[model samples]
Target chain A: MPPPAKIRIDLNSAVPAYRQIVDAVRVLLVEGALPPGSELPSVRRLAMDLGVHFNTVGEAYRELAAEGWLDLRHGRGATVIARGSPAARPEQLQEFRTRLRSLVAQMRSEGVAPARIAAELRSLTESLKP
Target chain B: MNSALFLSLLVVAFTGAFMLLVPHFSSPRYLFAVTVPAGFRASEPGRAAIRRYHWWVVRAIAASAVIVATMAQSWPDLAVVLAMLPAIAGVASFLRERSKLQGYAAPPPGVREADLAPDGDHLPRWIALALVPLALPLAAAAYLRAHWSEIPERFPVHWGAAGEPNRWAGKTPAAVYGPLLSGAGMMLFLLLLGLAIFYGSRRAPQRTAILKILVACVYFLGFIFTGVGLMPVVRVPIAAFLVATFLFAAAVIAWGYKIVTDPAQPVEATLDQYWYLGSIYCNPQDPAIFVQKRIGFGYTINFGNRMSWLLLGSFLAGMLGLVRVAR
Candidate 1:
């Protein structure tokens, strides 16, 4: 039997709950942790788990479905769907670089060394490999 | 001894017994469930505090039993009031124990963590079909129907301290069928409410425990209500029914406490800061209308939720109906 799909969210995080849901699920999808045909818990169930509003989870599911990573149908809950790789667009790449730079700067401000940051970045890249 | 005095003694004994179980329920094993880090259950302060709590409650219950059997008969009403002393003392002991456990500086990692709730269809398929309880009341009604011809025209509605019938009612359909219908209605209402609580609650052993207790209590109600329903026909002593009901209630409560505090079953009960007045659980962020009680071994309504207000309204309505029936 396939392993259960899992996602973790921090309620205390600065990020909004719905955004956290999207980020967490998208990572799982990209990592193939959630394969096509995987059934995500219903909005009510996930909302209950996360201790968030039902609409928050519903919005996240809708956003994922819009991104081609999930298929949401009435009464079926959400199902992961197959998505072909699409190279990062120019705007998306720019956005990633901006976020990466901001994160690195924040890490450096927190007294992290440049060498540690580079190594951490390399480790994250390595982890993405199948 | 008068029946009222005997009944009061029984109430005191049952209360004492229930108080004894509270310490175990409030123990770290059930409170934190498996959510706390390994070995925290064995922590010196927590274990010591729990042991202290158990010792206090046990002693209180023992003393209470002695007092009820001997001293209570002298002034049963006063004894009934005095009964609250041990129960109150037990609660104070538990609160102190709770304080000692909370004195641990480090919070459990799982305290902040959340469990993935089972699919919204978390209730067992069979629970949704829990129409079994309805049959108890119906069986009672059926029995009454069978003896319809010979049923008494006047029966005791209320019994006084001397065991003599004080209030009498003629065997109209209302008097005959009222208790049965109302009992059946009450049973059905409780079952539906239980279903609501079962599904509205998140993942935790207490969730199942609450449902089981609810089911068990309903069956007990079936006995009480059916007995009361046949009051006109069954000339059995009112004291007998009251005694039996109280005994059954005590047993059910004890059984429920055991289920609630089972060490083998780890729970994912979340302790929130929103527990208003230290008893009512209130969490605005939680979509669940019900959550496991932090101070006790059962579910409490989240006053923060809008649905909780509706539940309170319905509960009040039910209580009013019960009051009318009692009258």
Candidate 2:
């Protein structure tokens, strides 16, 4: 059998651990790495593995569950669920555009060429395609 | 040669050799329990520390052998203390070396990895074998009750190196049943320890290896103490017991050495600052109650964790209860 999907987090990163966990799991979910019906480690187990407080993993799992991606049971651990693709709202699209523009501005400020940035954007978009 | 003196010398030699090999048992990323860069153990400073540590251990062993040989006949009780010289000296040298190597301590790895799947948490089926030894003490207890008339009014409970009874116990209920009860208690304690290591520590191959050793030890304790309890009604050879114990211990140490020295064994990345004296691990931020030991083959409790205090407290209470039952 193939090995289970893994997630890595940098404890020294500027982002909070819960945010990092949420972002990493979201990426895996979108990339089809964590398929529906897949089980996630228990909050306590994941917290121990990450060397973080139990509440941190719990919070991340709660966020994912709220996003319709996970089902958290009392005794059983978190499990991935098949989430329906919701129609994008205009406000959500605007928020995404703002974030993307800010990221592109930062990249240009760091001396990235416009052509290189466009190429990188095209590669990511291609990867996101079904 | 006096058997006591011979045993003392044997212990000294074994301890000396074991202590000398201690530096090689741990991961190469660690020197004297302090985390170092890969291949640092072959560095000039690392070689010097190991050489000096060995020098002190050898001296301690020679001194212990002379003491045990000269003092065993006159003061057999002190022979046990003499046997500890190598370990005491080895620890002192190890700490000194660790302090010097602190300058070269590598940065603790900041990234942590974990699989989303939670499948490996179940205990191995062979762990059920630990339950099998629980019956030995129970069976001995049953046999003792049935053969009560055969038990003597007084029997040897302790023996000297010459196989002579050093202490006797009256054939009261406590005296007859204490050893069996204590053995059962010890077996239970070891089983609990094995469970704790399986559940409390991070997933690693060494965890299962240590658990297997614990299961074996539970079996060894069950047989040894059952034989002790039956000594009043049966002729049990003290020498045979000693030889068996020696062989069992030798096997355990050899197996443990092989597992700990395996390069593929994953070593936990713990901050050096959290480890006091390079042995006692204390990290409040770590959620794990047990962490892998840098100095030994098994897991050690994180003293800084609150749950660890509860475990330690319970263990001490259990030990006290065992002592009471034995008395």
Candidate 3:
């Protein structure tokens, strides 16, 4: 059997741990590595494994539940759910465009050519496809 | 030679050998409890440190052996103190080596990884086997009750190395059943401790391995204490119990050695700064109550965690209660 899906977080990173957890799980979910109906470790177990406070994993799980990607029950652990793809709101689309432009600008400032940036974006998008 | 003197020297020899082998019992990534790069243990400085440590330990053991042999007959009680010389020297040498390797210490790994799959929450089915030893004490109690008249009015409760009685207890329920009760309490404690380690510690094969060892220990305690309780009715040699204890300890150490030397065993990533004296782990931020020890094969309590303090308090209270009942 293949190895179980794993998530990695850098404790020394400036980014908050909860945000890192949320983003890593979101990428795995998008890539279908974590399929619908898959169970997540209990908050305490994950927190201990990650060497973080319990509240950090709980916050990340709650965020995913709010995004409709997970179902959180009282005693049962978090579970991935089949979420309906809602039509992107005009404001949400605009926000994504703005964030994308800002990221591209930062990469360009670091001496990345437009062609390289576009190729990197294409590679990531291809990986996201189910 | 006096048997007591011989036993004391034997203990000193065993302790020295165990201490000399301590460095090899940890993961290769660690040297003297400091995290180092892979293959660093074979490096020149590492080789020098190990050589120096062995030199000090060997000298200490020789000295301890001489002291124990000389003092064992005249000061039998003091021989026990002399037997600790090698272990004390080992610790002092270990700390010295650890400080020397601080310059070469690898930066602690910042990234932590975990499987998203839910696992290790449930206790193993074999854990129920720990309960099997509980029956030994009960059976001993029933046997004792059935032949209450056969028990002497006063019988030896404590014995010397020569299999002679040193202490006696009267014929009372407390005296007759105390050892059996204490044995049951110990088994129960081991069971609860195994459960705690399973649920509170990070999931790893080492955790399960340690739990199995604890189960073995419970069985050992069960049989030994039951035999002691039946001493008034049975004439089993005291040397038999001593030999059994030594054999059981050696088996446990061998099993631990196997786990330690296994390259595939994953070591817990912990900051060296959080470890006090290279043994006492106190990481306040880490949610784990028990983390794998860098110096040994099993887990140690994270003294910084509040839950650990609570557990320690409960253990002490339980021990005090056990002592009171055994008395």
Candidate 4:
């Protein structure tokens, strides 16, 4: 097996600490670096490692649990779960649409051509396929 | 003039002298335990800074030694404490450099992620058995039994700084054997503590040094404890004891320093901000019970780990028990 991948976050980043942890763990989960049934570090341990409050890690773990990526127990701690994809919802797509529009606008402002933007999106979608 | 005074002077002198070498105990390029990019610590300007630091430490040690030699006969206890100034100065330099190095060097590469694994690095389990000989204080106790008739009805159990026996204990078996028994108990306690530290450390180099020091201490303490316990009976000269103790200390420090600071074993760290005031390490993610000191030369307990606390508590209790037995 490959060496275990690590989740890291910048304490000095503009994003909130909890959000950084949530995002980092989500990326690890998506990339399958943290396999299903693998245990997450206890909230207190992660908080101490990140120099953040216990609630920050607890909140992040709760967020991941709500998103169906983890199972949190009162005493046993958090564990990854084999999460199937959520059903497509138009409301979620609307949120994605707004996010994409802002991203595309930012790229355009940076002088990226519309054709180049569309090509990059097509490549990302292709790469996502198994 | 007395055993207590000699012991005090030796402790202070040894501690202060060891303090002089503390800064050089870590990797020069990396900011000691934090492992930040200390480009300046290895640069021309950094060389000047290090030179100045060393110059001050030398002065502190020299002054402390002079004072210790002079006042040890008078105010022995105070002289011992005063002798700690050099080591204190060394720590001051370490912290000063840590702070200054932060500004002069780039910020630390923060929040490192390490693969959590149990890697035992080929150390044999039999190495721990080196502590077995710490039980030698018992032999001294046995000798006291053979010469039981020679023991006076009332003997000097404790002494003052003026070379006079101050506290007397009845020559019962309990009083006769107390110090040696305490020595045996203390050695046993320290052996357990050392083994815990050896197994608790994750870094291979640190573990190697911890093993050497712990094993070395087992033998060193065996002799020291047996000698100390036998001192009142055998009437050993204070000066001779001091010289032997100093040699043992020098050997232990030299050997440990050589191993732990071996350029081969550089300790790595991350999220140093959690290292409260750059001293106390509170990393819960780290599995090791003992970690290399971020600023000093030896092992420090991980305050975040519950097991570290338990170890500390038990060791302290053992120490108190040893003292009670000696008293």
Q: Judging by DockQ against the true structure, name the best candidate.
A: 3
Q: What tens digits encode model 3's per-residue C-alpha lDDT throughout B1-327?
A: 887787778778888988999888898889999998888899999999999999999999999998988988777767867888999999999999999999999988889898898977888888788888899999999999999999999998986543457889999999999999988998898888888888889888999999999999999999999998888788788878888998998899999989988899887789999987889999899999998888867888999999999998998899889989999
Q: Give the per-residue Cα lDDT of candidate 3 at A118.
A: 100
lDDT of 1 by residue, A13-121 (tens): 7888889889888877777777787778888777776678999999999999998988899988888888888898999999999999999999999999999999999
lDDT of 1 by residue, B191-284 (tens): 8778778777765566766777777767777878878877777767677777787777767666666765565755544553554434666777
By lDDT, the best candidate is 3
Supply the global lDDT for candidate 4.
Answer: 0.70
Question: Candidate 1 chain A, which ten residues in sequence have the lowest lDDT sum?
Answer: A2-11
Which ten residues in a row are the worst by lDDT in model 1 chain B?
Answer: B109-118
On a 0 to 1 DockQ scale, where is model 4? 0.14
lDDT of 3 at B215: 95
> For every candidate, what share of the true interface contacts is present?
0.31, 0.89, 0.94, 0.18
lDDT tens digits, residue span A44-86, model 4: 5555445456788899999999999999989777889999988
List TM-score per model, in order: 0.80, 0.95, 0.95, 0.68
Question: iRMS for all predictions?
Answer: 3.4, 0.8, 0.6, 5.6
Q: For candidate 3, what TM-score does chain B get against the true chain B?
A: 0.97
Ranking by DockQ: 3, 2, 1, 4
Please identify which of the two predictions, 1 or 2, would achieve the higher lDDT against the true structure.
Answer: 2
Worst 10 residues of 2 chain B by lDDT: B156-165
Measured by TM-score, how close is model 2 to the native structure?
A: 0.95
lDDT of 3 at B290: 91
